[model samples]
Target: MTKIIDGKAVAKKVNDQTAEAVTELVAQGVQPGIAVIIVGEDPASQIYVRNKNRKALKLGMHSVVRQLPVTTTQEELLAIIAEYNADRSIHGILVQSPLPKQINEPLITRAIDPKKDVDGFHPENVGKLITNYPGHYPVANTPRGIMTMLKEYNVELAGKTAVVIGRSTIVGKPMAALLTNANATVTLAHSRTRHLKAVAKTADILVVATGITHLINGADIKPGATVIDVGMDRDENGKLTGDVDFDSAQDVAGLITPVPGGVGPMTIATLMQTTVELAKWSDAK
Candidate 1:
């Protein structure tokens, strides 16, 4: 049987490290603060924000949540973000995604100060990622989480064939950039790609983020491959699962990350780590 990657356990390890960093920052007379703004009452977004807030508080960090009505205007939202941007206590700012129909998400993202764009969604951060310079922008948490897992597992990416199955800006594109930065030969595949399975089977490392549960199986993976499932899907019965068929892929792969205990927890942990890092940077100045 393939070794299962315990993301929950690993996330704890990451958080432990981040807790120490937070302590150090607090000792320097600076408290790390994260502001999360949700435009509408999206159930999933609310759940995510709640979990993040609880985790932040647990680690002695300041957690702020801003909830706006569904009918709130773009100007009103921007005004709120500007307040956080100017607030010296707030070190990291993340506006929960999928803003209401009337609001412009891109404009709001751009309005966030580059130093405080912890989600790495702003154009400034995006450009830094495309140019292979992570220092120029804040790195997205999901990609950073994946990289953190790989490092903890002692997985070497240099010259390895890494395939990312998605194209979304949040996960797919950023993941590919991160893998390439690690010296991996990366391929970004999408739905329209011809011979998808054949291409998928060529990778030493495979990351699925299509959000389609069980879309990939053993036939699409190489023997002894390392599979990273970045999907969170609900079945007809509302059971959460991932993009890859864990049972079948585990039989063929050397290592695999499960659905619930895999990538999800790590994303939040990475976000907290980034917040602490940003706070430390501010304190140093």
Candidate 2:
């Protein structure tokens, strides 16, 4: 029987631990705090911000949502980030993606203090990840969350053949780095790769993050492989789906994650976890 990776259950476990940590930190007079800045009124971004805020509060941490106008300039955003970087109370700072065309996204990412970079997109943090640096530093939550899930399921990583089919900063690059750090021989593939499915079939673990819906099917997956799909896309009927065809891929894969209940929940949960860790690290300094 193919085991479905229950991300919700694992996320609940993480959230529970985070709630306890928050209580302990409160007793120590240190509250984990996160400040999320959303540039525009993009419905999806607004929803994501709201969810993060609610989760932080529910976990007994301080949460702030800074809503900025669509016309907010790059300089204006950098100023806000600077304010948070110096604020002792805020442990994490996240600027939501899809910024206005006039804003330089990379500049905003660089502006956040490395210690408080919850999204972990800053060059310093990315370098730490690539170098597999020692000590604690935040990582990109989505891929970090996937790693958490993999550990929870006891999926073997050392010496395994892993393939990650996305190269974005958010998921692909970090994920491949992580797998490599875990001793997995990883292949990072993208849309342009020739014979993509053939490359996928050789993996003991396959992560599909390309946005194209149902891009990976049964034939593409190795039997008994662990398949992680990171795509949340719309099908022809306007329904939520992933890059891998769950219906077909499930039958061939040994382990798989569902679209709604899988990687989505873990991302927010891990963000909350990272916030608490940041607070603890800050207090130690």
Candidate 3:
């Protein structure tokens, strides 16, 4: 029988710890604040930011959302970021992705104060993650959440074979770094990789995040492997699906995370959890 990794349960545990941290910080005369900036009316982005805001407030952390028009200029966006950068009350800041074409997303990421980059997309944070920085640093939320899930489930990493399918900066690249840092031999694979299934079969742990619906199935999975699907793609029938075929893959995997209930919840959980930590780190200095 496949052991289903309960991401929601793990996320609740993480959020509970964060709530306590928030309470402690408040007692210390500091309320952790997260400023979420969003541009345009992207329905998906709006929902994501709203969820983050709601969770932050539920955990008793200070939360703010700044909604900008789609036509907002680069200079205008930078000015708002500058305001947050200088504001001592704002402990962490996140700019939702898929910004309007006129705005440069990477430029905005660089403009944020590294200390307050909750999204962990800042070059400084990415560099820190790649180099295995000795001190505290934020990581991209999804990957961070995935790692938390892995730990909570006690999935062995040291000397294990882990294959991460996809190479996006946000999830794939950072995920491989984390697994490797944990002493797993990591293989980062993508669309161009030849004999992809053969490479996948070699993994004791497999993570798929290619944004392709049902891109992987049981045949691609090693029997008794741990499968983590990071995709939230929609199938032809307009139903939410993951990169891996859950029905078939689950039968083959020793442990597997489901589509909606899996890695999705962990992303926001890590965000709020890391926000609390950032506040502590900032206040400690």
Candidate 4:
């Protein structure tokens, strides 16, 4: 029988640990704090920010949300980031994505202080992750959460084969690097790859992050492989779905993560966990 990976349960465990850490930090006169900056009225981004803020507060940490108007200029945004960078109380700083076209996204990412780059998009942090550098640096939460779920389920990584089906900085690249660091042979595939299904079938572990809904089905998966779906997409019925067709994939795979309940909760929980770590690291410095 195939076993389902319970991401929600794993996330709860992470949140519980984070809460305890926060309490300990508070007792030591260090309250872990995060500042999230959202630059537009995008419905999805607003919902994400609200959820993040609510979770942080619930975890007994300090949370700040800075909502900027859609017409805000790049210079204006940089100034706000500088303000947060100088704020000793803020341990983690995140600027929500999909900023207005006039804003230079990469430049904005570079502007945030490396220590406070909780999203781990900054080149400095990314370099650390890619190099498997020995240090406490924030990593992209979604992929990091997946790693946590893998560990919670006792999924072995050393000497395994992993195929990640997206190349975006947020999930794919970091994920491949992480698996590589864990001694898993990783293939970072993308839209242009030939014989994609064949390539996918060779992996002992697979992570599908491409936004295309139901892109991978049972035939594309190796039998008994562990499949992690990182896509959040709408199906024909306008309902939430993932890159892998869960129903079929589950029948063939030994381990699988379901949409809506799989990777989503873990991402937010890992974000909170990273914030606490950033605070702890800052305190030590």
Top lDDT prediction, candidate number: 4
**lDDT of predicted model 1:** 0.90
Native-to-model Cα distance after best TM-score fit, residue 69 in candidate 2, in Å: 0.5
Q: Ten consecutive residues with minimal summed lDDT in candidate 1?
A: 276-285
Greater-lDDT candidate between 2 and 4 = 4
Rank all candidate structures by their lDDT, best first, as comma-separated numbers: 4, 2, 3, 1
Report the poorest 10 consecutive residues by lDDT, candidate 3. Answer: 276-285
Summarize candidate 3's per-residue lDDT along 1-285 as a digit string, tens digits: 899999899999999999999999999988999999999999999999999999999999999999999999999999999999988888999999889999988999999999999989899999999999999989999999999999988999999999999999899999999999999999999999999989999999999999988888999999999999999999889888899999999999999999899999999999999999999999543
Rate residue 282 of model 1 by lDDT.
67
Instruction: Predict model 4's lDDT versus the native.
Output: 0.96
Native RMSD of candidate 1 (Å): 1.3
**In model 1, what is the error at residue 209, expressed in angstroms?**
0.5
> Which regions of candidate 1 deviate over 4 angstroms?
134-136, 283-285
Candidate 4: residue 174 lDDT (0-100):
99
- For model 4, residues 133-244, the per-residue Cα lDDT tens digits are 9968999999999999999889999999999999999999999999999999999999999999999999999999999999999999999999999999999899999999
lDDT of 2: 0.95
Clashing pairs in 3: none
Model 1 per-residue lDDT tens digits across residues 1-285: 688899999999999999998888889888899999998899999999899999999999999999889999999999999999989899899999888889988899899998898898888887788788735458889988999998888888999999999998889999998999889999999999899899999999999999888999998999999999999998779999999998889999888999989999999999999898878776333
Residue 70 in candidate 2 has what lDDT?
A: 100
Q: Give Cα-based local distance difference scores for all models.
A: 0.90, 0.95, 0.94, 0.96
